[model samples]
Target: MKLAELAKELKIPTESFIKFIQDFDLELSECISTNFEVKDDFAKFARENIVFLRKYSEDLNQNKSIEDIAENIDQPKDKVAEIIKKDKPKLFDNGKYKSSVSSFGIDNKLGGNYKFVYNYFGKNTHLAERDFIGYRDLFFFVSQTLEPYLSNISVQDWGIHRPAGIVLYGPPGSGKIFWAKKIAEIIDYEFKEIKKYFLGISFVDDQKITFNDFLIQIMKSEKTLLFLEDFDEIMSERSEDESVKSDDEETKEIILHYISHFEKENILMVGAANSLEKIDRELLAPGRFDVLIPVFPPNMKERSEMLFHHMTEDLSPDALLIKILEDNKAHQLPFWLEISKKMQAFSNTMLIDFTQSLKKRIRNLYLKNNSTTIKITQKMLDASLRDASSKLTGTYLDQIQQFIYDVSLNNYEDFTVRIEALKVEVEHYKIVDEPTKPIGFTHNDEIKQKK
Candidate 1:
C-alpha cells in the first residue's frame, strides 16, 4: 500500500508516515511514486495491512501475480502483495514490535522470545544463587514446582520458557531486595531495575501508559528480569474520599495483566513490597503471582549462624554471649559486628565493663526499633544485668516471666522484683568466683570459662 494509506490506517498523520519512511533511511524516487501502475488513491488501506506486508514480504512474494498490482493499488490483496515485494518497506524491521533498547543501550531480542530485565540501582551488587539468604530454599522450591508446568507445553506449540515472576512481601529490612538480586543472578536473567518514582511518572495525568505497553517491552526481550520495588506505595489503596486518588485500581489492572500474560508467555516479572497487608488482594491472588514468598527476619538458628559468621575472626565471645546474642531479637549480625569492634578498642580492665555493656547496648538498640535518638541509661542496664544474673538460679525462669510481664506493661513492682532477683544472682556468682583471680592480674577473665 502507499505510505499515505498505511499512515492513515495507523492513525498517524501523513507527514509523520513520510517522516517514518525517511527514518527508515529509504529514498523513494519521484518517478516511482508518480508512475505507480494502480490508479486508486491507496490511502485507505489499514495500518495492519502495511504491517503484514512489511513483515511477511518473503512469504507474500510466493503468491503475487503481476497483473494484480498493475491493476489497482487500492485493492487489498494487490496493495498487500505490492508492499510485500518492496526492497525495504516502512514497517519492515522498524515497527513498534521491534524492541528499542532504553537509554542504557542494552540489547533487546524480541523474536528470541526471552525476557529481559535491567537493573540501574543494584549495579554494584553481584548476588549468587547460594548467597540468597532467607529466600534461598523458597527459590529452589518454586523452581522445582514450575518445572512440570513448563514441561507440559506441547512441542507443537511455540511457547517459550521464561523465568517465573515472584512477589517478595514483608516488612522493611526483611531482605526482599537481597533475594531479588540473588534471583537475578541465579537465573542468569538481565536485571531491569525500575525506579518507583519514574514508574509513577510514566503514568502521570491519568495513567497515560497502559500496563500492556510495559509488559510488551519486557516480554519481547530475551533473558530479562523485571524487578519492581516499593510497588505497594506506588499502588497504595485509597478511597475517593481520601486525598490520595486510588491509583490502586489502575495499578492492579496493569499488574493483573502482567501476571496473566507472563505466566503463559514465558516472561518472568518480579515485584516486591514492604507489606503484603497494604497491597491489593487482586494482585496477590493465586493465578497471578503463582507464588507469594514472605521474606521474614532471621530466626534464632539463622541469627546464630549470622553472628558466628560475622564475629568468628576477631572476637572470642563465650557460650553465654553466643546464646544471648541468639536469643535476643536485637542481636543481628550487623549489630554484633559493631559490638565486636567496640570490644576490640577497650583495655583489659575495661573488658569486663565492656562485655557487661554489650547487653545494654543490645537492649538500647532493641528499644530504638521504631525510633531514633533513644539512649540506654544506667537504670535500664542495671535492671537488665540484674535480671540476666538472676536467671542462672532455680527461680530464674519464673522471675524472667514476671519481669517480662511487669516491664512490658509498666508494672513497677514486678519489674523491680525481677531486677532484684537478678542482682542477687550476679552478686552470688561474683563472690563465689572472686578468689580465683589475683587483684593485680590485668588480663583476668571476667566470666568463668567453661572447659
Candidate 2:
C-alpha cells in the first residue's frame, strides 16, 4: 500500500506517518526533479514532509477513518488531523537531505581532478538598498524574476514559465554577492555560498568530475536556491578565449543543457558574473539567462540607508546629514558604515560629533589616496557596485570624500585620527570580495581608481 493509504487505514495522522519514517531512517523509493522526473536514488532517504505529501497524488486511494488509523498506529487521532491540515507543498525534496555544498569546497575546475563543483552564489537581499533607491525599475525586474519562483510552491508543479534565468554581472566589490544574499532572505529562502578556487577535476581512472559537475548535481535541488556567486570564473567568455576553452565548453554545454531543460514550474537558477561582456554569449541567450540584471554600487539614497542600517544609536535622518552624504561619490552606505563603526570604537559621541567624525574619516580615506580610494578595492568591493552611481554629498559628504582622498595620497597624518575623531566602534565588514578569503586588504591605488 502507498504511504498515505497506510496512514489512513491505521487512523494515524499523516504527520505521524512522516515522523515515523524519519524515526526509522528510511529513504524514499523514487527521487523526483522539478519537472516530476523520478531520478535515481537508492539511498532511500525519505523525508517526513514528502512521506505525508504522498497523499496529493490522484493515484492514491484512501478508505480509512482517522480514529481507526490512529488506534492501529497507537497514536492520537487529533495529531493525525493536525499534520494533514498543516501540510504545504515545498520547493525542496521533502525527505532527501544532501551534505551541504559547502563541504565540497569552492573553485573553478576545468580538467584538474575534481568531478563536480558546487559553488554557492549570493542571494538577492544583498542588493535591496539599491532597489529602494532610484533604481526602482532594476529592483522590480529582479523581484519579478525571483518572486514568482520563490513565493509560490506550486510553481514547482505547474506555473508561469519565466523564460529568463537571472544573471547578475558586474565588477568585484560591487555587492553582487550581497544582493544575492539579500534576495534569498527577503523571500525566506536559505542562503548557499560557493567560492571559485576549490573547483577541480577528480577521478578513479576514467571516471571524472568537476566543479561544474558538482553544481549541476546540486542545482537540481528542490525548493532551495543555488547561487553562482562569482560565475564568471568558470562560465566566462574570458575562460573560453583562454587556454581553458575545452573545459569551458564542457561547463557551457552543461549550462546550455539545463537552460533548455529548466521547467519554470520547478527550479530557479541564478548566475552572477563580474563582466557581462566577458560572459559566453551562448550562456546568456534567451533560453540560458534571459534576464541580465546589473547590480551597481550604492547611490546616495542607498548609501545613506546602508549607513543608517549599520548605525548603533539612532541618528536623525536630518536634511543636513543627508545633504552632506549626497556629495561624496565614493561614500556609499557600506563604506560609511565601516567608517562609522571605526570611529565609535574610540568613544561614544552624539550625532553632530559623529557626523563630523564620519566626514573627517571620509576625507582621510579619499583625499590622501585619491578621491576614489575607498577602504575596499574595486575588485574587493561588493560585485554590485560595477553599475552603481554615487549619491552621497554635501558638507559632511565632502569632508568624508576629502578624507578618503587624503588617505589615498598618503597625506593624512594618522589614518586613525579620523577613526579616533568619529569616536565610533569598528565592526566586521558585512560584504566580502572573495568567498574564500577570510579577510581582504584594499590597496591605496586600487580604491582610488574609478570605473
Candidate 3:
C-alpha cells in the first residue's frame, strides 16, 4: 500500500507521518520505498499502532512546554526538561517548544518502549532495490508540491495550479539539476535545457533567431521543462555596484514577459541557482519563479549510503575490490558510519571524489604488494579523506551556511530536521584557534606578566 493511502486509512496527516519516521530515526528504506510505497512490515506496524500514532501526531503538531509533554507522556517534569535541554530543540516566542521539536525523539531518549519500531526493520531492503539513497523527505516534498500536476482534482477542486517557474537553489554539487529533471519526470514533461547559446541570438535551421523566438518554438512543441542554469546571475536584480550583461537583461525580460503563458502552453521553467540572495523580487512574484526548493548536502546516513554505493557500484561479486570490501565489512553501512561521520557537510561530489581517491590508493597498494589479500587500513582512509576535504573549503562552507539561512527563512517548516542538522555541521568549522603563549609560561603566569 502507498504510504499516503495508509495515512488516510489511519487518519494521520501524511506530512506528520513523514516527520514521525524522521524524528524516531526509523530506517526509511526498511519502512518505505523511495516512491513512498509502504512496505508490508511498516503497514502492519502502523495499523497495529493506530492509537499510538494518532497521539504522537497530535503531540508533534502542537507547541508544548516540558510540563505539558511530561503530563502527556506520564513522565516527571524534571526528567522531561532534562531530556529536552539535551536535545536543544527550537523554542517558540511563548517559551514553549516548536512542533519541529519531535516528542518521539524526547520519548525515545527517556527510554520509551520503541523496540517495536525496530521490529519493522527486520526485513532488509537492498540498495539495488531502491531508486536512490536517502533524501526520502525531499522526494516526498517534491511529490507534494507537484500534486496538482499529478492529480487533476487538485486543480479542479482546490485551484492549485502547477508552478510556472521553480528555482532549485543550493551550493554547487548539491545536485539541483537532478531535482529539476526529477520534477520534469514527475509531471511527464520532456526535459530540455535552455543552453547558453539559446539565451542569445542564434541561427536555428540556418534561420536567424533570438531567445524570444526559441521560447516561442518550445511553446509550440510538446510539453517541455525548460531548465535555466546560473539562474541567480541571469535573474539577478540590477545594481549600481555590479554591471548587468545586456544578454542577461534581455533574457530576464523575455522570461518575465512569457512566464504568464508557460502553464497554459504546457511548459515549466526550472531555474538552477547557487544562491537566491541576488535574484530580483519581481521575478519571484506570484505565478513566476516563486517556488524555491533547496537541495541539500547528504546527511550522515546518506553519506554512508553514497560511499557504499560508489565503492561497490559495478564491481563483480568475485572482483578483488569486492573481496577486500567484504573482508573489511566495508560493504555494510555500519562500516562506513564512522568514516561518514567524519565527512560531515561533504557534498555529493566530494563523496564521489573520496571514493575515486580511495580506489586509486587501493590500486597503488595492490601494485606494490602484488597481493589480493591487502587489507584496507585507517591510514589509507585518512589519506582519501584529506583529498576529499580539499573541496570542503571555507568558501563552500559559507555557501552552505547561506543555504541554511535561506531555507530557514523559506523552507524551515518543511525541512526543519535537515536545517537543524546542517546548522550543527556548519558550526563545526567555526572552532577558533587558541592564542599562542610564551614558552615556559603557565596561564596564570602569562596573565600576571601582562599585568
Candidate 4:
C-alpha cells in the first residue's frame, strides 16, 4: 500500500505516516511526500506493532510527559528517550517538544501543547476518592461521565458526535464548583476556568482568535474539564424570535461560540448554574449537554452526614450528645439526626455555619462556671440554631421542588422517583416527638387541703 492511501484509510495525518517511514528505517527518501510507496518491510512493521504505534501517537499527540509516555507503554523512560532521539529528533527542540502528529491539512489555524495551562487552574486541589461524597447513586452517575476516557469505547457507540458535557444546577452554596474541581481531579484532566479567560480578552478580534485557538488546542492535546462558573451570567439565552441586543457583542459571541463548540469538541464543558430556567432552551439539545444534574440542598440523610461529620469531632460520649439533643426536642425519635426537619432544606454551607455557631455558644455557656471545660449543653445548641440562618423559606423550597420535578422529567424513571421522594419526605417532616418523661402535678389538691 502507498503511504498516502494508508493515511486516508487510518484517518491520520500524512506527517505521522512519514514518521513511520523514518522510525522503521524503511527504504524511503527524506523528501518523500504523502504519495510515497510502502515496501514489504514497512508492511511487516505495521502488522507486528500497529497497536504500539497507535498508542505511541496518541500519547505524543496528547503531549504527555516523557515519564508518563514511558509508564503507559510499559517501557523505561531512558529507552523511550533513546528511541525518539535515534528515530525522530525533529520533535525535540531546545528542551521543548511538539506532538508527533500535528498541523494536519487544517491550515495551521491552531496548534500547541496547553496541558500546563489547563492543569494550572486546579494546581493545589488534591481530592481523594472519598472527597466526592454525596449520594451513592449520584457518585456513580458522576463516575460514568468519565467512561470515554477510562475505556477503549468511542462516542459513536453511544450515537453522540462527541461525548456529552454535564450541567450542574442548584441553589447557591450547594458545592457546584467544588464538585467540578473534584471530577477533574478524578480524571486527571486539564481544568480551565472560563470567567477569568473572558476578562483577560482585550479586544473583539482577540475574542474570536482566542476562542478558536484555545478550543483547538484543547481538542488536539488531551481531555479537559472547562469549568464555566457563573454560567448564567456569561451565556444568555439565544433569542431567535427577535433581534437580541447586547452592549458587548464580543462577550456574547465568545460565549455562544464556546457553548456551540461542545457539540463536536471531545473536552468536557462543565457549566454551573443556580437555575436551569436561566439557560437557553435550545442549548439543552442532546449534543450540547446531555446531562442536567440537579444539585439540590442536602436532603435529610445528607444533612445528617454533614452535621455528624462536624458535630462528632469531639471525644464526648454519644450519651451526652443524645441527652443534649433530647432536651431541645429538636431531632425527634432518632437522636442521630441533625437539626429539625424544618432546617433540612438548608444548604451544606448554612449547616456548617450553624454548627460553628453552636461551638461558639457552647464555649460561652461553659464560661458561666469560670472554667475552660468543653462541656456542651442543650441550651447552647438551641440558642445557636435560633441564631443561625437555618430557615429556608417555604417559597424557595417550593421553587426547588418544582425545579427538581422539571429536570427529573428529562432523566430515567428511577431518578425521577428518587427526586420525588424528597418532596414526600418534606411534607411529613414535622412529626412530633413522644417524650419518655411525664410531669406530675399536686398543686390543686394541696390548695384544696389548705382551704
TM-score of 1: 0.36
Q: Rank candidates by TM-score, best first.
A: 3, 4, 2, 1
TM-score of each: 0.36, 0.38, 0.82, 0.53
Residue 369 of model 4: what lDDT?
A: 57
Where's the lowest-lDDT run of ten residues in candidate 1? 101-110
lDDT of 4: 0.53
**What tens digits encode model 4's per-residue C-alpha lDDT throughout 1-451?**
5554454556654446554433332223222312234555555555455674565456446654456555555566676565454323233454534565222111111222333222322232111112433454454455445534443333544532444567887767778887788667655677888654543333455444355455566667566788877665455575565343352334445545576665445578888977776566645676665577767677676666566555534434554444544454423424436454546557667777777887566556555555444444556656666765534444445445555655566554425435655656545432245323121112334437969
The worst-scoring run of ten residues by lDDT in candidate 4 lies at 101-110
- Per-residue lDDT for 1-451 in model 2, tens only? 2333333444544334333323222222222221212233311222323433343221123333445445544556576545433321111254321221110111111112222111111122322232232333244345445544443432554565554356765434445676676566545556665444324576536778676676676556654455776566567665444754565557666657666655542345577775554566777676667666655433334344444443322435563333434454333455554443322211111222334444455456666766543443333222222112122212223233333333333313222233233212122322255545332323334346832
Local error of candidate 3 at residue 442 (angstroms): 31
TM-score of 2: 0.38
Off by over 4 Å in 2: 1-137, 150-160, 186-188, 202-209, 238-246, 313-451
* lDDT (Cα, tens digit) per residue for candidate 1, span 274-389: 55445555555666654555444343334333433432223345533344445543334444443333221111223233445545565456565743334435555455334433
After superposition, the stretches of candidate 3 with alpha carbons farther than 4 Å from their true spots are 1-11, 23-56, 74-121, 152-157, 428-451
40-146: candidate 3 lDDT, tens digit per residue? 87888889989988988888889988877887777788988987765567798888988756667677778888887777664555775555778977887887787
Runs with alpha carbons beyond 4 Å of true place in candidate 1: 1-140, 145-165, 202-213, 238-249, 310-451
The better-scoring model by TM-score among 1 and 2 is 2
